[model samples]
Target: MKSITVRQLADQFQLEVLVGEEQLQREVTKARAHRPGLEFVGYFEFFPTEHVQILGKKEINYLHALTDLERNLHIGNIVKYHPPCFIVTSDQSGLKYLKRYCEEEGIPLLRTKLRTTPFIGALDAYLLKVLAPEISIHGVCLNVSGIGVLLRGKSGIGKSETAHTLIRRGHRLVADDVVVLKKLSEQTLLGTHNEVTKEFLALRSVGLVNVVRLYGRKAFQDETRIVLDIELTKWRENELNNELELEPKFVKYMDVSIPHIEIQLQPGRDVAGLIEAAANNWYLKQQGYSAAEEFMKRLEF
Candidate 1:
């Protein structure tokens, strides 16, 4: 919904408005074109109407030969135009005639030296993040029922060793390395791949192994709601005033909120048992029961 005017574009790229200074203040809803591969072009289609476009060096000559109607049509000016501006990529003064015509007709022109590809790529990536939908769902997300529970223990507290036991307990692997998160809506967080990553878990002794081949397709989920976020920390023997007991705490990502569970990792603890318990406890909460609150009410009685 936000837009940049021709004057703003000139300020952004340090380009001078050669002609149509009065018209140069027109707002551009989208980039007409960008240096290919840049992230700037993807936001163009988001507005209700087409606003402005980048007129590169290649198309400058063809535009000058056209008549009034032809000039308007070829320059993408059909329908009730929102008053378009141009980002001229070249510095040549040969286009002065065209500039004179534009000034007479009150069309704005902006100049920039950056190539087409790189500018567009940057524009696209930014728009994708801005326009992406985020959502939240209460579904259990795991790989092979174990392995890669993603334990984040304070240095040398035993996350890798705990994962080793979980692997030995018949839980296959998905990704022990890095997990990628996708924002699907205003309230949905979907876990997926980072494109450049492979579906493998890397342990210290063993480097990397393909999870799909070993655990079948079930271990590699395309996407799943991040219903739980378990953070592992060193054990504490003090009072358990704020210890989690199946009570849901939501985490926000890309404007969406998702339930999270933080578990403490420690020595001699049955981690596999705890993982299963966490999953089961989440199920119970989904079914409308709260063990911690229920036990507290009983104490009052």
Candidate 2:
């Protein structure tokens, strides 16, 4: 499982370290933050140990209301559970006993100046992005007419060459050779280039080339939401030619299905132009305009 360390979170949010200096390397496995309100009141059965414990103003006020013995008992139970870390929000700084306890137990305790709600929201977003399910695809991803199109095919089938042609024609390339796809949410897949291969494309004979440097920054995009999946296949003599009325196809990745299309590869064919047209056609279909349906309507009329 992918996990983020306390030190990384502290550096990202500029959290102040109040105690547990040696626990900076503790790993946070969960994306959700936990509020220890109930735990502070001696409800220990349901306390989440994997989540980062967040103490807001209300919880702190409740803590301050308790006698030293009561507070020690409550905090001691929490410390015994060994949570990933603790965060006090809103810059409140009157928890000397809690800080001392955390220091003694070697549990990382941090404080942030952000309000409780916004801090929780931001942390949730960051964790979601970092911990989201990811997969690598052997294809090229591009933004064509605002639609993220992923081109897939066997080696030497001109996927990269087609992407290069599309780039030259003003479309932006998200990734070439290998596209790293991350499921940002249930229905959304975000595609990005592998770090070592960012902005670089490998051609058959021309070798490695930097698309961003050659065509400027406009030719490359950092990431794009994949909406369409297209596969290129070698042209066959007896292949069906129902070009106007193609059935809807979908390709599933990471439990999400995206619209899919297949294009035949042949000599003297404008594959790049066809891809651009396919992207625009997909956009039109999204707007409730289907050329194939319109043609079928005309035929029936």
Best by TM-score: 2
The digit string of per-residue lDDT tens for model 2 on 1-301 reads 8898999999999999999878899999888899998888778788789999999999898889989999899899888889989999999978999998898888999999999999999999899878878999899999997889999999899999999999999999899888999888889998888888899988889999999899999999888999999999999888857677678899999998999988898899999999999899889988999888888899997
lDDT of 1 by residue, 205-294 (tens): 666556567666554654445555655666667733565353457656666665555566555678667776775676677789988879
RMSD of each: 12.7, 2.6
lDDT of 1: 0.53
Worst 10 residues of 2 by lDDT: 238-247
TM-score of each: 0.47, 0.86
User: What does the lDDT come to for candidate 2?
Assistant: 0.91
lDDT of 2 at 204: 89
